[model samples]
Target: MKLGIVRCAQTEEVCPGSKDFQALREKTGVFAKVDDAIELVGFTTCGGCPGKKAVFRAKSLVAAGADTIAFASCITKGTPIGYPCPFAKRMIAAVEGNVEEGVEVLDYTHGW
Candidate 1:
């Protein structure tokens, strides 16, 4: 399955996302449960605060052939930073509601 990753804009400065990408490529952590080979179709931020851009980004990823949209641990689980996005739930919900039914939404990309 092809996937897209969404992260918090604030975390972008400090986190290069190499760990998350590596985990996905290695099928480790949260990606271990997947049986099929996963491809990264997109990697982007929520455009900051309120995360209104999540919907648009998810849709864009889906259009680019991503079947799954995974929220990075930085936003959902807050690995490394120790502070998750307070609006993560709402942003995830909005992206879920806006995307097509076949598109899958994951709460996190990789584990700490």
Candidate 2:
């Protein structure tokens, strides 16, 4: 299962946190854990609030071979920020409803 990770678009540079998808990928070994069952084939941002193009990007990723789509914990889990991104939620819905029917959409978050 090819996986795609979507994160937030940061404009202001600052000391990054564990919220970073790449950092989490390294720490969690998500790809390695899944091994040949999954591949991190696509990565991108949700284009911030409103996330107008998110669905399109997700579709493109799926078209490119992503069998599953995942949002970074920071966006879905609401870690550090204390609130989940409305745009991310919207993107998830859009991707779920509009993308390929069987593609899996995952939220790398906890605590709802």
> What would the TM-scores of all predictions be?
0.96, 0.70
lDDT values, one for every candidate: 0.91, 0.65
Tens digits of per-residue lDDT for model 2, 3-74: 777765542133143344444355353333454444678777777776777788788889889888877655
By summed lDDT, the worst window of 10 consecutive residues in model 1 runs over 76-85
Instruction: In candidate 1, list every pair of residues with a backbone clash.
Output: none
lDDT (Cα, 0-100) at 76 in candidate 2? 69
Q: In candidate 2, what residue range of length 10 has the lowest lDDT sum?
A: 11-20
